[model samples]
Target chain A: MTADHLRREEWAVTLPSLGWLLALFAAPTLLVFAVSFRPADPYGGIGAGWTLATLREMARTPLGPVIARTVRLSALTTAICLALAIPCGTCLARVAPRRQAVLLLLVVVPFWTSFLIRVFAWRMLLHPEGPLKRVLVTVGLADPHTQLLYSEPAVLLVMVYTFLPFAILPIYAAAEKFDLALLEAARDLGAGPWGAFVKVFLPGIGRGVLTATLMVLIPALGSYVIPDLVGGPGQDMLGNRIAQRAFSDRNLPQASALSAALTLAALAPMALAALVQRRPPALEAAARKEAA
Target chain B: MRRSRWPPVVTAAVLVFLWLPIAVLAANSFNRSRFGSSWEGLSLRWYRALLADADTWRALRNSLVVGVGATLTSLALGTSAAVALHRHRSRLQRLHYALVYSPLVVPDLLMGMSLLVLFVALGADLGLGTVYLAHTTFCVSYVAMVVLARLQDFDPSILEAARDLGAGRWTVVRRVLLPLLAPGLAAAGLLAFTLSIDDFVITFFVAGPGATTLPVRVYSMIKHSRNLPAINALSVLMLAATFTAVRASRRLLQEDRP
Candidate 1:
């Protein structure tokens, strides 16, 4: 009725894995964190000496506006992606099983190609004389040459397109595992459809929501590609701004400061993911397994 | 529950909407006279132009080097970690698993930037090597997570039986462990290749003077001239190549799915 206590031998196999991860993955990040506190070059005050100036400088500058824009765009993208994905997952989960698999494959088809090509395809769509332009002109929405590329809306659209798969995949996983009877129970207990969903179904999808929000938020925020090319020159975000300072401005100090800000910002979702995964349900499963 | 076509209808519509830009770019690639989208007639002239372009070749080579290099590194590091973790159940095993998952959670930009700083402080030359290191750091974790998921139901008893039947650790591993884990390893490796080839953010941050990737080149072109036929042709070519590989990988993984 139980695993052999001689399973102690298994511990021998697993220890080195912890060592390997710590050495390779954890060590590198530790190095990054350590170096972040060091001065990039010390011309401003400490003369290439150690300084809090970098961390302090994070709050200053048009950096606030820059980061705010990045967060806003990323949040909007996450909301839109989830908004589309939730119903999409519900559809897939509730559909006939054979048909649902085909639909899921279809949703994931775009993920089959390079992300670069997918984003580039959008370029073709929004081009001046492109089909979209032709359609718009045909329908008389705007002029033939009205620029669609390099705008905030374009950036948002690309973000949604790129991340929509991320949202759907996790939510679909959750829905597949969802106990529909609880939802029916809620409905049976004088709850309307909306109430049933809010009270019974939402909690079942909680982990999926967290995972999808997380998956969307991290990339959407630091994404240099969509915002840089699609959002254009003036739409400089944290990523674009950092790349600009590093490559264009060649200001390593400023870039270092920007990099530190980005690292802290990236930690937000990561920390939340860590917290969620350690929650009672997941931890209880692990603990129960250990007790067995 | 009554089924609704509205959900599927909306989903299909959204997908088409998503593909609009791709359709536009691909459709325009064949337009005889490019200059954005002045369609004279259907022709493969732009693809010919794409094939002939020097920068295109250079970028393609750069992307291949980065992709192959990063994939190899990730497989080596990631597979080792997955194997170790698969065998290693400890007090902090869940935390250990989450540690491997951290790279998945971090933004590519942060990883790129942090690597840039880390390499700089070490006085390491900023080049393709640094780029590979950065790419490997993030990709290895993804590979580990995927592989580990595939390992959940795997039986350790087979290894014990092989050992009891007079096999050494290496022999048991070579004959028993590797064969069972082979499909998962292949999937992880293929996924890493796909991710590395498609990567823009991390590579953008960590690449040096000569490490200009295809996406970077294409990105600049999009910024300057939004409707270049060569870019469209290149996208189509890349799409074709990726589809072929993805299909092949799918077959390889699926065949082992008994």
Candidate 2:
């Protein structure tokens, strides 16, 4: 086929998908950007007036606690997921090929279930009078009547549970490509364990770390259900607030602005991941060449 | 060689943490206690109740319709995009990937919120149709991502060889490319179906009255009522379906891998 013919074919193949995305995905996002700047109607519909007031109103709204709590929880969740997933990924990468597949299957199978149900399951398990609570009491971790549900810790636990697979998947993908000999070489060159990890191991898996961070942090920040079912009303996150402003209160403009703010927050990690993901290939290829 | 003991221990512990709640849910589904506080005895009464509820069946029907509709549409769009990206390598492909992946990063709350606003702006009715559209929008990204990954390792010369035999472009795609892509298509289809069925936030915003999905129904049931057994039974059934679909797709993809 001629170059022009292939190019024409490419466009032909791409147009339908791109057009669908542009219409349903991209344009709708732009609409959100536009709608965020519009004034709210008296009754709940959007009005004609255009202003920056809605955007600025995000500052004055009492969203500080929610934002702070969300960031704190997301940070903790991301940290825990990273801590756990890194080892899991390392284990996965080091295992035999058959064992690796089985382990991965085990990791991924639970995620196939409804995430909502999984979260609800956590609610049941953490119920003040549930079996898990009984187990905890019997194990002497807590006295009977100790409330495990409707608490901050429950939200954090569920978030970590829900997002651990996300962290582990990318980390495992990156770690699979890792050259284990590099770690040995670093250690043989008189580097201490911590030094080997910091200089060689960490940099080798930087892309995975970045990907896992973005995967865990963004979703953890936007999570509402965990908090709603487990954390109670006082523990509302950015997601709950946005849902409330839009659905319950019928306040679209403020909700739009909050959504925009959330998009900004989530975008930060995505931007970092994109940068990390792009740069690693060039660096790795160069390293491979040098080693050869 | 010194073996690190912590990795397996930590991994197993994390796995336990992950499955413990699910195990609780599964076990509680069979427990007779209304609160699942204690296992009085094993019973299928909750399952009987779940099976008997008309609303449950209606919601299940809606979820199935939505799942099927979204998956089919997403497979079409996502496969095309994957094929295009695979065939056309350029700087623009990076932009395509970013655009394709944008929905994955965009919080569901925002994705749903924005679409709700857009629908209102367009004066579109919020119903099963809107839910399908919203599900399709996000699901396409997942499908595209999965298919694109599969295509990365695909050999392009097969298409050329087929074309060299005087096959038309459509014939080459149909006779050769589609066969190779079948596993990816199946995986993407199942992924999209599962995602659509489990989606709550997006459906919550787009669904109008009389269009409740299973997740939305379960949420309301949890909020409005205290009975946990029926919901547990329903969740277990959904879980079983999801597990079967995922296993089937994984088997397909695994068998095709070189």
Candidate 3:
């Protein structure tokens, strides 16, 4: 083909993605950032004033506490999911290839179901009159629990359950790519199974763990629904507070400011996770081969 | 590898934890008990009641419309965009990638609220149509990212070979590229289906009075009453349908393995 034709074809390949990005994401995000600066009229329309007062109000409200709680809860949830998903992922990696699809589907089954329905189901499972409490009572764990549904544990449970798949996919991708020959060689040199896992396997899957952590942590940090439906009174996350500001209190300024801050707060963990996800090229290619 | 005893045991326990709530809700939907705890005996009374409830049917229909419509739009947009990105090498590809993936990182509630503001300013009317637009906006990226990952698995040499064999671009894409990408597209479409169905926050912001989805309907019902029999029945149906689809996909994925 002619050089000019090839150039035109290349441009044909590039423009649509750039167009979608410009129209859908870049413009929309700019609109949001611009909204943060526009003055909120009392009647819910933008006003002439452009000031930092809305941000100042964010400092005085319950935003600081909400942010702190979100971080603590999300961190705990991520750590727990990691603890559970890693070994499970390792098993999938080490097992027979024939069963991999069924096993992998199991990991993602919860995702296929609605998040709202799953959380709603948890209500039935955790309520005082629910099966969980009945079982606990039958087992003599205590008198049927009264506070399980709205407690911190409920929030934690949903968080972990909802995001655990994120943790598994990455870690499994890495662990499956692990150098079996390396582990075999170590075993030949008298390394025990546990020793091989620690020295050989863990480091191999570290990037996957890091990426999975990112996959879990970012969404968990700014989560809105779980805390609202399952979180106890006075233990609200920043998301609920933002919703309240916009809807109930009609305080759009404070709401926008709170959202902006929450977005800003999530950047650090996300950046750290992204940095960790950028593994050595050899490691990435290994993961891809394993995936194949 | 041999079947170890520990994995099945662990998998069983985890699956039980995962599936029990859904199972309970499904069973209780048939129970005569209003409290949702005891087995007062099986009954289809709740299903009859759900059929007569106009609001419930409306929500169900709305959700179907939204889910199917939204998924189709995303599949089209995302597939095209992923194909374009897959073909060309550009200095800005990573930046473009990071942008598409950004929606995944931000919480849905924030996106919902900011979008409400943006849409209002731009004078886009809010309703079921608006919900469709909102759903497609985020859904495109998700569908794109997954399809892109799948596209990366494909060897570039195959496309080059098709081109070198004197095939035009359209012919190569139609015959060679599209067939190979089928599994990835279907997976992306199914995933988008789940996402559209699960969505509430964005829908809540963008949805108008004429269009309430199933989740919104359930939320509204819970707000007004404690009668969960119907809710449980609906939940059961939803769970079963999604699980069946997922299992079927898994079976196909396994059989399709090269």
Candidate 4:
């Protein structure tokens, strides 16, 4: 068969799914974008008139605090996840290869449980009369009436707990390929431990750290279930507001606007990461030469 | 061997933190107390209640149907997309690969809201069917990624050899590719099914009246009622099911390697 015929045949393979994605996935997002520009009706639907009221109102009051809190919480979650994951990832990489797989699996298996269920488990454990309270009482650390279930700390705790695996897996993947001999060589050549770590260790797992940070940070920003289940009444994240507008208030136009803005904001970090991760031609050529 | 002992200790502590809540959850499922704090004694009262609840069973049934439907459709779409992308090496095709995988990165809330907008615009009633479509949309990206990872190590010479031996496209696909891809497909389908069953945020947005899923049902119950031990029992069972599904998928993916 001719090359043209082969190319056509290959194109045929992608045709079906491409059509499905365009029709279902792309079309819906476009519809949401369209709705965001429309005015809301009292009858729980959008009207034909165009208005920027939703966008304007979003800039005014709750949206600013919501976005600010979301960012603050997400950044903290990412930082804490990275701190915890890096040491654990180092340990994982240092272990025997066979044991490493088992350890990694242990980290991932808990993630397979329902996200809501895990959040609920945290709610119970942090409740006023929960195990944590009892532990604190027994240790004489605090009064018996201390409540952790509905506070900012509770939300942060659950967010970190939930996203910790995402942080660990990527860092572990990066650290697994790390070379300890380089560190030894650096030391042999007269570099201090801190110097060796900064020069040798960080660069080795830099990609993994970036990947882990983005993976955890992006989803953490969009979180709702954690705050809803564990947070106090005033702890509304951007997700909670978006979801409330859509489901509770039935304000489709405003919800669409907020969701559209949130989606755009979420896409920024992913796009930047993708750009940063693109392999350089020099590295590719070096790799090819090494392979040869 | 006088290495620092901090790594192992730190790792152990992290693992404990990871598994403690789950252990507590499972333990509390059998607690006789209404609130799952104090342990009176082991009992099956909550499980008995879980079994007797018609709403729970109905929601479970709804979850299963949605899971199966989403899994099958995702498998077909994902496999085709993976195969095509594997064969093409052009820049546009590389972009296509990125687009196919974009759903994996986009947050679920955005996916749910956008799909809800689309369905409402089309005037389709919100229910299990819409939820099925939404699930399939995201699940396709997941299945495609898994299968594509497997396909990367695949040899293309086999297809050329099959064609050289006078095999038609259909014959080559059925005789060669299908058997080779069996393990990957199984792993992908299992992953897709688990995701569909575990999904809450997406399904909750799309599901209308009389179409409450297991997760949605459980969420509403938790929101409305403060102290229900039955939920703990239900959660424990779901946890067991999730573990089984993940273990099965891991095994299938391992088998795919060879």
Candidate 5:
């Protein structure tokens, strides 16, 4: 086929999905942004005129605290996931190939199961009258009346559990491709063991660390189920408030505002990363030479 | 070449943290007690109750219908997009790539909420049809990603060879491309199906009255119902289904690697 024929064929093949996403994904996402600027009708619909009232409302005390709590918890979850995943990925990379496959599969199994069911499992385990509480009481580590479910720590714990695999897989993928001999080379160059690790090993897998952070942080920030099932009223995150506005409160414009804020917040770091990546080639080359 | 012991120790501890809840859930599925606070004894009563629950079965049926619909639709859309993406380079393709990729990064809740707003604005009644649409939107992105990864290692010379052998355009696609793409298609289909059936947050927003999927049903049951053990039993069965599907997809992908 000629290049023109191939181009026509490509357009033919691409148009269907392109149209579908444009209608459902792109248009709807833009609608969310547009609706955020509109006024909420008292009857659970968008009003005739547009205004910035919803955006300003987001800065008020009620939603402000939820946003803060969401960011804090998500940041904590990302940090904890990184700390655990770095070591875990390093070990998986160091293991024999056959064993590495099995270990990776183990990590993926829980992730494949239903998200709701996993959260429910945590609920069952952390139930006030459940076996865990019984064991803790038996070990004298907790009083009989102590609660495990519907607490901030429980929310954090489950958030970590839910997002841990996401962190591990990317780090493991990057680590698997990483050359371990570099560590030894650094050590031979008279760097201390810790120094070698901090300087060489971490930088070698830096891409994975960034990928893992984004993976964990994005989902953890938008998490609705974990906080809903495990967190009490005081621990409500932005997701919970968005859900509340959309469903219970029937405030569509407010929900859109919250959703828009969240979409922007999630995309900000990615945009920053892209900007950093688009630096001048000369600068990149200079940085490469410096590293060498 | 000496390995530090701390990494393995942390891995084991993290694995335990991951598996303990699942183990507890599976074990309690067979518990005779209603609350499952403590096991009275091992019994299949909860499983029996779960089997006999009409609402649960109906929800599962709904999930399967939506899953099959979404998977087939996404496979067609995603495979075509992947092929076009792999073969072509242009500003339009870049835009297409961004559209295909954004869903993967956007939060599920936002996707659901935005779609809900769209439907509301269009005066479209929410139902299983809306749920199917919402599921297909995200599933297409996943299927495209998988198929694109498969396409990365594919050789274009195979298609040229078929054409050089006097095969028509349709014949070459039928005889060469489809066969070569079958494993990828199958893997992507399984993944899409798994994701569609397992989805909750999206379905939760789009589903109308009498359009409840399994996850939505289970969420309400967990929130309200007294039958905790039956939910446990249901979760175990769902977990088993997920394991089989994921394993099969992995095997297909592994077999395709040459």
Candidate 6:
């Protein structure tokens, strides 16, 4: 009714969520950073005091390969998703407006289904005696003994499959807003279709491309289930190791250290983008726009 | 200008790639086979087995309980946060915005691990309660985002008009605001429920030995290759539910549009 009342109402509304998040989200994130410095007790608990021992141990541990592998796999997944999504998004954008909603729903239905189920489906499809393997073998594309399950390529393939919709939606959102006349103009200026696509269409949807990359890349980096289910021992990513430390080794501090490293790695590109352009990364901006 | 065939070809290929595995899984759910490597014949034996499995039922129950609890909690918190965020502009709200937004971007693994550490530090037991807490943490952000989007098209004058007509603040909210926000809230609630129920990574970390959600149960079943056909059956059911919920949410949102 009044300014004072409105301000009070705002605070009243804000405080509950603010307190909840602070207690749960903020405090826990800070706790991860704090615990990363603490010692791991032998009995699956944090030790009494703080130490750099965990960080020092992490430095000496052979995490380089895992980190490198995580980045490589995630980057590859993002690249592949982008390549596939560009055309898919372009096609969706060009579809009849009435059919666009149905097609988008088709894309989203698989995404909204249980993530584990999708990953499990991949496991089934890639099974040694599965139909896919049998078909490939029959076509002389694979040795009969060769398994499609449990390999780096398997992980990459599933990751691309899993995150492809994420990439496509954002690109489609951007492409839908793009002007078609620009392409015609580019063609009129003597550019071939390929040149017009590369020169005009790509730049036109640059924000969407950036958004799609981050959407795919960030989740791929933090992926645990994909690599664990479909990947071999040699394909352990940072996520797998982080889970192993917490669940198997019961090393809380080490797990915290790993999680902290992952949090930084995930946020690094976003922060870097923000710094370079003096604006929030397109992912966050796109999210806000989507929310609005 | 002539239309290139590349877009349609690529689109079809990608769409098939997306749906093939799901279609295979759905088809195999009816397969009267043990391994699900090949189809024997169309039958509902796996579905019957899934119904007979007590463990799957228990996990599904746990998922429903957590899902409903998290959805209700996040709806209240997220709706309030969204309304406050939409109306207010200040440094504190900006900080609140960051708090709300960060959870959306933070990796589930990190969020799960961090919460596990926090629970361990606080000596809280890992169980469904912890999973509920963990889920509400992220669900609130999603709910807020959805509500905020709904609020973007809202007209503040309607509220002013109600107030001028001698409606009290609560009356205005109850009579006008809540009705207008109902669609957004329902969509947000459905989304929250779906996310909470389908969540595995976070629930995996926070859930005690006794507190297995459906996804976690499905994960172990997949790992052990136990009753593979039954998992297919359950996957099909869950997928059906997800699709229905998504469609319902879309319909609600579309109906809300002028």
lDDT of 5 by residue, B60-138 (tens): 9999999999999999999999998998999999999999998998888889999999998888889999999999999
lDDT by residue (B184-243, candidate 6, tens digit) is 999999999999999999999999798999899999998898988898899899888988
- C-alpha displacement of B171 in model 6, angstroms? 0.5
Q: Model 1 Cα displacement at A202 (Å)? A: 1.9
lDDT of 1 at B172: 85
lDDT of 5 at A214: 85
lDDT of 6 at B67: 93
TM-score of each: 0.87, 0.95, 0.89, 0.94, 0.97, 0.96
Error of 1 at B79 (Å): 1.6
TM-score of 4: 0.94
TM-score for candidate 1, please give it.
0.87
Lowest summed lDDT over 10 consecutive residues: which window, candidate 2 chain A?
Answer: A268-277
lDDT of candidate 4 at residue A43, scale 0 to 100:
65
Model 3 - which docking category?
medium
Give per-residue CA lDDT, model 6, range A1-292, as digits (tens).
Answer: 5999878888998999999999999999989999999999888989998799999999999888999999999999999999999999999999997888888998999999899999999998999878899999899999999978999999999999999999999999999999999999999999999999998899789889888888888888999999999999999999999999999999999999999999989998787655645543675688799999
Candidate with top TM-score is 5
Q: Report the number of the highest-lDDT candidate.
A: 6
Top model number, DockQ: 6
lDDT of 1 by residue, A1-292 (tens): 1355435454444454556556545665566555545565432211255667666775566566777889999999999988888878877888887897567667766776667667777766766655677888889997766878788888888899999889988998998899888877877788887777776777789889888898899888878877765677767788888777667765566676676667778777778787877785876698799999
Per-residue lDDT tens digits for candidate 5, residues A80-101, read 9999999998898889988988
User: What's the best-to-worst order under lDDT?
Assistant: 6, 5, 2, 4, 3, 1
Can you write out model 2's per-residue Cα lDDT over A138-177, one digit (the tens) per residue?
9999998688888888899989999999999999998899
Clashes of each: 4, 0, 0, 0, 0, 0
lDDT of model 1 at residue B54? 87
- C-alpha RMSD over true interface residues, each candidate: 3.3, 1.2, 2.5, 1.5, 0.9, 0.9
How many angstroms is residue A18 displaced in model 1 relative to the true structure, after the best TM-score fit?
6.3
TM-score of candidate 4 chain A against the true chain A = 0.90
